[model samples]
Target: MSDAAGTDATVEISTDGACLGNPGVGGWGAVLRYRGKEKRISGAETETTNNRMELTAAIEALALLTRPSNVVIWTDSSYVKDGITKWVAGWQRNGWKTAAKKPVKNDDLWQRLLDEEKRHTVQWRWVKGHNGDHYNEIADDLATSAARNLRDAP
Candidate 1:
């Protein structure tokens, strides 16, 4: 959406992930805010890791943008924040291997994140989890609720 200034609105987003077990039912959630308008979205996967879900939340939210945008994403997962901001470039340069020469885990989501990131000017900020930050808490609730529902599904 464009602002009154005729420029693309900056989007503010908060994302989170949850799992019933480390590699069990996993869910991801994202809340996107643009020009005072907000959207909340969440999803689940039967077998996945929390880190993958976190990455998925960010990827899914950013994917909703139809054009390049200025976006800021707040996340509780250091894996998501640091992976994208601190580690991805090196990972790419090393052919998705870590400095220890080990293959990067969740390289698939990392690749997808990198692609989505290219379409926006994004700033990733890490927020401490369970700290009563409104947006983070909402995202966490959404993720946990989704995971719990999926886990309880018959």
Candidate 2:
């Protein structure tokens, strides 16, 4: 990977998640590419929501970075992008309640993502899912494959 302009080093990661059912088997996938090398990571949960898998993809990707660097994270989920960039602080201040005064959903995963994000210089980028973007497509494929594998497992 190329160094991001004005930055000493950079890593670009794309992530996606899939669920066989909203609260059923799910999988998360992430592609972490840097310094001309690429790594793909994925996992499956027997029972999970799509949003939870989405958050897991991001959390796992960031956890792979051992040191701080300028990082660009690409995802198709606006919930992830906006939740981290726009709403997390307010939620934290509100003791994990939404602006509507309801307890935040998936606060555990959100908190994990927040912790991982704080360890790096992160830029969140949103892409349209199922689009032709190469990395995003790969991530999506990996997620779907993982989910399928889980579904097929005895």
TM-score for each predicted model, relative to the true structure: 0.94, 0.94
**Cα lDDT for residue 87, candidate 2:** 96
RMSD of each: 1.8, 2.4
Candidate 1: regions farther than 4 A off: 1-8
Tens-place lDDT per residue, model 2, 1-154, is 4344356768999999999989989999999888789999999999999999999999999888777768999999999999999999999999999999999999999999999988778999999999899999999988989999999999
Candidate 1 global lDDT:
0.90
- Report lDDT (Cα) of residue 129, candidate 1: 93
lDDT values of the candidates? 0.90, 0.91
lDDT of 1 by residue, 20-105 (tens): 89999999999989988989999999999999999999999989877788889999999999999899999999999999999999
Residue 141 CA displacement from its true place in model 1, Å: 0.9
TM-score: model 1 vs. ground truth: 0.94
Error of 1 at 86 (Å): 1.0
Pairs in clash, predicted candidate 2: 1-36
